[model samples]
Target: MVSRRVRDIEYAIRDIAVIADQVKKKGKKVYHLNIGDPLKYDFKTPKFISEALASASHSGKNFYADSLGVYELREEISKFLKHKDNLDITSDNIVVTMGVTEAIYFLLAAMIEKGEELLIPGPTYPLYINNTKFYDGVPIEYELNEQDDWEPNLDDLRNKITDKTQAILICSPNNPTGVLFNEKKVKKIIDLAGEYNLPVLSDEIYDQITYERNYVSPASLSKDVPVIGMNGFSKAHLMTGWRLGYIYYHDPENKLLDLKEGIAKLARARLSASSIAQYAAIEIFKTKSNHTVEMVRKLRERRDYSYKRLRQIEGINCVNASGAFYLFPKLDLSGLKKWKNDKEFAIDLLKKTGVCSVYGSGFGKYGEDHIRLTFLPELSILEEVYNHIEDFVR
Candidate 1:
């Protein structure tokens, strides 16, 4: 027995990608608007990042270092958190992982017991739900009301809590939606979790990519409650292929010592995440260059233009994405006589318009009529995509 539920789920977006591949084989320049990978969208690693990696590659520190990450890197991360999120994170609380994906997976594996539940937001990232199932933990999803600008429904959240709710995952500047959590909402969720004595696993990989409001770490709101703040350099530093990420546990009183030790053990068992990647990450962490800032500025510009363009389109309605590189637009397939669902719409669009976007149905239950488009493409391409989509929808 593999001790895993191998057949329970299939990442459907990747499945759709198979069809997309056929389109690519046909020599139709398919606009890849599906994945959130910033590097694929003309983003280059900042000069500081390259310089840091170059220095490390030349350095004789070719061997593996501490499992908790390099001492200097952890220290720099602590300083960065203190300055950026106003949290008093120390090096002791930080555990470097391959990426935020590994950090989340590790944490879920360590903390989740059989039959326990993780409260995930609907129309959210798929990994949270998948990981929950992989651990034999139930994923109890609460829908994020799109009509409410895609904020977490507090009533639904409060009602969803039970004795078995081990943790609640919050992805601010959330994927698909790009809705940044406000201080009030964060406080409420923290308070509710505190009441139930549950942990909050915060995925903040897109923190630095915000356009309108500032990204707030849940750990900053309360030192009293335990918060596992997961972040990595993949998105912000344009180092997705580097596979470097880390997690910070702000337990305040060493409440997570046992769990942290287990995570460290798991890290060791994996023989430590890519040593070269970690070395390169340490350098990226130390620099305050214009690379990430410039990327954020460009993404914001794209977000504004895309929102305007999509809104102008007669049948497409998109939420104003405040962060991240995606815009989830609800297509009015009601008028289209052929397609009945977003999947068919996506297939038809790829076949007709050569615009590839993953259907929103893959984003859990609530995203039936939607499609996720990464605005990471250049302005001209976006303009062209809008023109194509407009013509197709009309």
Candidate 2:
């Protein structure tokens, strides 16, 4: 009887080891800008994906391989999304899970129904609010405006739909505000989920981790809306522990074939997701290299040097993140009057400046006074994590 929803998703990163044990009891040098594992951030993985996983582990092609995966990696994910997003995809609307975090927990346990409702927006990506409360559903949210850059209000997603909502999650170049939605505001949230017929779940695992805008896929702005579209090879092929991931589906006449057969019976009960990492995701999707275009030009030069040292630190503000490798900011804490909110100003700035980052109120409820920061580290450790967060916020 130990599933109090997997013990509240195992205390969701419990303030990352209580801020890495208060920055190792104050010896400092912490700097881990709170999680998004690009192989712990110096990003390595392509040597043709470790030589096609050492030639499919000596060419035996290991055991389990067809739980909707490895049909030539879903025919190389339908020729890598019809040569990268010219989409009208195939390979039976793909599935191949075990990464876009189990293709977003088997597309929210195959299109969320138990007590339904999903919505999503406010500082999203806490695993889509812990897989919509571990599949019992009901996670709603809808705020985004950090002064119109974190964009997505569509009348607060059409007044948080009803008739038990069911779906509408998004995550553009967005996971803690890397804000990229504008393709005419993603065709007006795919015509407001095709006028509330609902079904969107679009994570796009940081679509090639963008920078100066252009990573669209809300199923290429609506084949009349029903888009599951998750993606992976974890952040454009750094292959986050090569768990591999995929989940496309434009709308097989929309009932979603019993939600793609409950994600192919939970991808044949998790029986596949590593067939030598799908034969090393077919040599990292046919050698599309330049290592994610030099890791998105060094994450747009660490999002322009941490958005110019978080706008010269006076009551921080940020939002210039035109792609992933997060930023979020927004920290006045009004003269730090012995803080009480943004998770006690990020656990008192990780007990005064070891700088571990993460409390955008754990990515929901309109990120109470913000803090997500992950400039993926190194530009001299993000210029000493911006001079220890501007000398612990002055």
Candidate 3:
């Protein structure tokens, strides 16, 4: 029998991807705007990082290392966090996992019990939903206000709180929306967590993917409210395949010691994250690559281009994306003849024009009228895809 968990699980990001694959098998050229992988744009990983991994492997550093990641890499992570985010964190607080994906899983496993609830942002990355279900934890979604540049409706968050609420999750520079959380909003969330005695899990995978704003590290604002800082090299460093992610548990009150120990136990059970990847991760400190700046420049250009073209389409409304490479544009299908829902709109658009985009409803219930499109492809491809979408909508 399939497990109840399996029956309940759905990952809309990759789930929609299966249809894209089916389209490909029919010999149609699908312009993929589905996944957040930057390497798909023909962007090469930095040579120094690759060289470090090669050196580590050839020098027989392939064997399992420390369960909580190598002390060296952990130290570098601590310093990086301190320098970049100004967090009063150290190596002792860091735990390296396979990726931020695994870091989240480990953190969730440590915190949640069956039937408990996690307060998560709606139109979030789908992993939060699937993983919560995997452990039988209920997800209580708080909607982002579309009318307010996708900020969380704090009253909605206040209303959703229950005794079963275990933790609050925030994704700044949010997936799908690409809206960076303002300091006031984030500080307010932190304040709420403080009053409720709930820890906040901040997914900061796209911490570097911002423009015209400084990304706030949630942990930096609190010494009392425990903050679980989740980050990785996937989005920023173009190291998606490397699977290197780390978590820092910051609690001056020492409320999260048990949680940290639980994560360490899970880390030990998994044996260790890739030792070579850990080695490669440390070189990020040593190697300064101008490639990242250029990548961000290209990404900003693509974002502006996509936003401009998407707005020109008759029934589409997109808020200007301030960070990351995605645009969660609302599909105003009321005027359109062919579609009633975002899923049908996205799938039919793919089938008709070979442009692959994810139905925003997959992100959460709040996203039904929207579609998530990645701007990871170059400008020419984004322009072409937008052209096809404009034609399809007509």
For model 1, residues 1-394, the per-residue Cα lDDT tens digits are 6544987765766777788899989888888887788788778887777776777768866778777787777888898899898888889888888899899889989988999989988887888878888999998888788888888898999999998998888998888788887779888999988888888889999999988788878888876789999999899888888888889988976677889889988877777666666677776655557888899888888888888888998877888987788888887777666678998888898888789888888888887899988899989999999899889888
The lowest-lDDT stretch of 10 consecutive residues in candidate 2 is: 10-19
Best-fitting candidate, scored by lDDT: 3
Candidate 2 RMSD to the real structure: 17.9
After superposition of all CA atoms, the RMSD between model 3 and the true structure is 1.0
lDDT of each: 0.84, 0.80, 0.89
Candidate 3 Cα deviation (angstroms), residue 336: 1.8
With candidate 3 superimposed using the best TM-score fit, by how many Å does residue 115's alpha carbon deviate from the native? 0.8
lDDT of 2 by residue, 98-208 (tens): 888888877778778778888888877787778888978888899889888889888888888888988888888888888888888778877887787787878888888
Please report the TM-score between candidate 1 and the true structure.
0.96
* Candidate scoring better on lDDT of 1 and 3: 3
- Look at candidate 1 and give me any clashing residue pairs: none
Instruction: For candidate 2, list the clashing residue pairs, or say none.
Output: none
For residue 378, give model 3's deviation from the true position in Å: 0.9
TM-score versus the correct structure, for each prediction? 0.96, 0.35, 0.98
